[model samples]
Target: MAEEEKTDRIEKRRRQSPKGEERRAEILAAALRRFAEDGYQNAAIGDIARDVGLSLPGLLHHFPTKVDLLLAILAKQDIDSADFIGHFRSDLRSLLKGMVDIFRRNAGMIEVVRAFAILNAESLMKDHPAKTWFLNRTARMQNDIAVTFERAIAEGSIDGGVDAMAMAAELIAMMDGLQMLWLRQPDRFDMVGGLEAYVNRLLTSLGLEH
Candidate 1:
C-alpha cells in the first residue's frame, strides 16, 4: 500500500506539471490577445485573467506582473523566431530567402505581428519596460545580417565594395515598413511578394544569382 501510494503521488505530479505549463501557455495567449488589441499600457491584467477564466491571483501566480507577462510574450516570440529560422545558412542567398520565408509565415500570424507592431511603437517611449528589448532585438538582427553580408563578400559571392552595415539597415527598414503597411491593409498588400522583389533586385544589383 505504501509503494502504491508513492507511485500514485509521482504520477499525480507528472500530470500536474504539464497542466501547469498548459495553464501558463493559456495565460500567455490571453495576454497576447489583450496586448495586441489594446496597447500594453491600456491592457488590463484583470481582463486578461478573466479571458483565461482565472482569478487575478491565479494569473499572478504564473506571471508576477503585467510587465512580466509582456516580457514572457516577447521571449516566446524570440523563441518562435529562432524556430522559424532554423539552421541558419551562412550564404547570403539562403539567408535572404529565409527572411522572406519568415515574412510569409508572419502573414498568417496576424495577432503576433500586430502585437509586435503595436508594442514596438509603444516601447519607443522612455518608460516602457520593453524598450531595451526592442532596441536589443533590432541591433542584434542588423548585426546578424551585416555579418552574413560580410561572409558573402569574403566568399566573393557579392561585391566586397558594398557597405554591409548600410545594406543590413536598409533591409531591416524595408521589412519593418512592409509589416506596418501589411497590417494596415493586408488585403491590398503583397508582403511576401514585395520582399521577394526587393531581394531579387538586391541580388541583381550585387551581381549575384537570383
Candidate 2:
C-alpha cells in the first residue's frame, strides 16, 4: 500500500509539472497578443490575465508584474530566433542569405513578428521597461553583422572601403522599415523577396558574384 501511494504521488507530480509549464506558455502567448495589439503602455494586465483564464493575482503569482511578463516574452523571442538560426554564418554572402531566410520565416509567424514590430517601436519611449532590452538587442545584431563584414573585407571578398558599422546600421534600419510596411499591408508587400533583392544588389556593389 505504501509503495503504491508513493508511485501515485510521483505520477501526480510529473503530470502537474507539465501542466504548470503549459499554463505559463499560455499566459505568455496571451500577453504577447495583448502587447502586440495595444502596445505595452495601453495593454492592461487584467485583460492578459482574463485572456489566459487566470485572475490577476493568479497571473501575478507566475510573472509577478507586467514588466516581468514582457521581459519573459522578449527572452522567449530571442531563444526562438537563436534556435531557428543556430549560429550565424561568418561569410558575407551566407550571412546575407541567412538574414533573408529569417525574414522569410518571420512571414510565417505573423503574430510574433507583429508583436516584435509593435513592441520595438513602443520601447523607444524614455520610460519604457523594454527600452534597454531593445537597445541591447540592436547593438548585438549590429556587432554580429559588422563582424561578418569585417571578415569578408579582410579576405578580399568585400570592398575594404565599405564601412562595416554603417552598413550594419543601414541593413537593420531597412529590415525594420520593411517590417513596419509589411505589417501594415502584408498582402501587398513582398518582404522576403525585397530583402533578397537588396542583398543581391549589395553583393553586386561589393564586386561579388551572387
Candidate 3:
C-alpha cells in the first residue's frame, strides 16, 4: 500500500510538472502579445497577469517581475535568431535563404516583431531594463556574422579583401531599417522578398552568384 501510494505520487508529480510548464508558456505567450500590442512601458505586470487569467502573486510566482518576463521573452527570441543563422552556417546560399526565411517568419509574428523593434529602440535610452541585453546581443550578432563572413571568404564565396565586420554591420543595419519600413506599411511591403532580392544582388556583386 505504501509503495503504491509513492508510485502514484511520483506519477502525479510528473504530470503536474508538464502542466506547470505549459501554464508558464501560456503566460509568456499572453504576455508577449500584451507587450507587442501595448508597449512594455504601457503593459503593466498586473495587466499581463489579468490577460493570462492569473492573480498577481500567481504570475509573480512564475516570473518574479516584469523585467524577468521581458528578459525571458528576449532570451527565447535570441535563441531562435541564433538557430536561424546557425542552420545555414556552412552554406552561403543557404545563409541568404535563411535570412529571408527568418524575416518571413517574423512577418507572421508581426506583433512580436513590432514589440522587438520598439523595445530595441527604447533600449537605446541607456536606462532601459533591456539596454545591456540589447547591447550584448548586438555585439554578439556582429561578431558571429563577421566570423561567418570570414568563413565565406575562406571558401571563396565572399571577396577576400572585404571587411567582414563592416559588412556584418551593414547587413544588420539594412535588416533593421527594412523592418522599420515594413512595420509602417506592412500591406505594401514585401520584406522577405526585398531581403532576398537585396542579398542576391549583394552576392552577385561579390561574384558569388550570377
Best by lDDT: 1
lDDT of every predicted structure (CA atoms): 0.89, 0.88, 0.85
- The digit string of per-residue lDDT tens for model 3 on 17-37 reads 999999888888988888877
Candidate 2 structure lDDT: 0.88
Candidate 2, after superposition: displacement of residue 34 in Å? 0.8
Considering every candidate listed, which one attains the maximal TM-score?
A: 1
Model 3 reaches what TM-score against the true structure? Answer: 0.90
Off by over 4 Å in 1: 1-10, 83-86
* Candidate 3: clashing pairs of residues: none
Q: Estimate each model's TM-score.
A: 0.92, 0.92, 0.90
Which residue pairs collide, candidate 2?
A: none
Q: After superposition, how far is residue 141 of candidate 2 from its true place, in Å?
A: 0.4
Model 2 lDDT-worst window of ten: 81-90
What residue pairs are clashing in model 1?
Answer: none
Q: What lDDT does candidate 2 reach at residue 168?
A: 92
Off by over 4 Å in 2: 1-11, 83-86
Native-to-model Cα distance after best TM-score fit, residue 77 in candidate 2, in Å: 1.3
